[model samples]
Target: MTDLAPLPLSVLDIMPVDVESTPSGVLRATLEQARYVEELGFTRYWIAEHHNSPNIASSSPTVTAAAVGGATTRLRVGTGGVMLPNHAPFVVAEQFGTLSALYPGRVDLGVGRTPPHDPGVARALRVDALALDFEQQFAELLGFLRADFPAGHPLQKVAANPPLTGKPSLWVLGSSENGARMAAHRGLPFAHAHHFSPQNSVAALRTYHREFRPSEYLSSPYSIIAAGVTVADTDEEARFRNVPAALALLKSLTGPPEPFPTPEQAAAHPWTAEEAAWRDQFLAPQVAGGPDRVRAQLADLLERTGAEELMVVSMVTDPAARRRSITGLRELFGSAPLPQGLAL
Candidate 1:
């Protein structure tokens, strides 16, 4: 057993579109942030996929990954996840194959089983894209990665062309036990979405380790737990930064979705007794405060989960705060070095 300590840290950029940030600006900011984090010794930088979200600019994780990969040289770059339900596994394999070709040895393909949270966005991506079989999709994706289609299979001869120098290391992204079990059965690393579903993080990771079976990918369980963290130089500043996204999300539960609120707007918005409760519940999983406070909270979380790595996604609209969050962690954690044989 290891002592409670800093783990390998990775970045999960959800590509949030803040009020003052345009799509182009978001993309540019993402690239710039990726470069800075790599310099600070983050292990990997991942882009999350969210389709048709008025507040999320990362609709195409791979394209954005290419941009991030092109911008930074050392840290791993790939999707925090590409939702398998929305696209054919074959296409995903080819896309990552090309990505691996371009960046070789420095790509991590984190796959998710779910589709867009919005039903309309799912259908618009493709008919029945939301209801596809995740297990089958995962199997086919692996097959395509290695061109290992079984005899008599229609795609026996087709491969993810351009040729892969190496298959991107695969990690299963889950918010529940379902994803953890799937990853365990295949011996792949599992990443629990503790940021979005902290309630399920412990149980899901326990399931992964308990049921894990040896496979080519792993002989034991390995996991990354993602947290929604907002850290600033001062505790007050961090709380101030957290309000914008929380308020915007709370308002979004009703009919029309609201654009991300600025810090000023968040401060001025009237808070109702009921709305305050909802916001508190929503932010329950997040670590928000100064570097020391954030680190203490994260350390407590790590002690409970025993996660092999830590991945952070700050959903707030303040890009400067996000940058400072990374810098603060750099001071607290120093550096995170990736494990050997983590990515194939």
Candidate 2:
């Protein structure tokens, strides 16, 4: 009926290492960016987990979360998700338990099914049983967090220790309906990967709401949707800033990730017919514009998705441009922190 109000915004970063930057530099930049965004009133700062990728430095999101949590006092920090097949359930619980002990009331634990990279890489990651065992392992992880198991269950005795006052707020991260169903069945909050998989996002969120069953964790449905946003002083400049992320993503889909491309490289590259088409599709769901246009696009998206919160992935290659994008977006979320009830 009317324009939707600006949604509560959060941050999701991969600590991208561009062709011009080193992994060490990107890591340091992540800490700096986390503090900056927290000061801007972003609800949270979460890192994505990606491995065997030259462009992404956040190979272990949990550890990165610890670093981010230490760098900022108020922002909730956690994995946008941990790829569950990469680690044991007990170990994941233990790791987050330690984080909760340190951060308390500010940690979030979001998990997803693993994406098998290359064959060799998948083998090296020990994810051979990923597809078959994901649900079982996911269940095991929740059990560890809940500290509840059937009577006489062997896992009952083996608990994830360092028990603390707060358990990390849990979220199920997905790009498809399968994870939605899993999250709904468990009554955990769901976060859809709309930035990468726009086609499935609406369906996934609807599925989550339709099938949701209340559990000890939550009494109602809650969802967050991630979107790629690039804002600048002008629409043309915003498009220029977003080009490198689209190009790097296209390259990664075709083969192993290369160094994240720089804006100069993006400008120099020839846009073939098919590549241009692919880039258009990749950028279609994302928002890239100056202030007025960005506000309009975000409002339209909120009305369409009905997400309680929005997680932003700014895809600017230059560190300064990325920071500008972050700062530019802070106005959309007003000055107050997002109000949330943690289901810990």
Clashes of each: 0, 0
Estimate the Cα RMSD of every predicted model relative to the unseen true structure: 2.4, 2.2
Residue pairs with backbone atoms closer than 3 Å in model 1 (clashes): none
lDDT tens readout by residue for model 1, 1-344: 22235567888998888788888888889989999988877888899987766888888999999999999988899998998888888889889988998998899899998766776876787748535788888888888887779999988888887556643488899999999998898888999999889999889999998989888768779899989888787888877787878887776778555568888888888989998888778877788887678878888888788788888888876677788888777677644543432555
The pairs that clash in candidate 2 are: none
- Among all windows of ten consecutive residues in candidate 1, which has the lowest summed lDDT? 334-343
* Per-residue lDDT over 1-344 for candidate 2, one digit per residue giving the tens place of the 0 to 100 score: 23235456788997777888888898898999999888776788899988888888989898899999999998888999998888888999999888998888899998988656578767887767636588888888878887887899879988888764543488999999998998899888999998889899778888998999998778888889899888799998888877888899888887877887877788788999999998878777888898888888988777777778888887665778888888778765565555643435
TM-score of each: 0.94, 0.93
Candidate 1, residue 290: lDDT: 79
Model 1 bad stretches (over 4 Å): 1-4, 129-131, 335-341
Candidate 2 has what TM-score?
A: 0.93
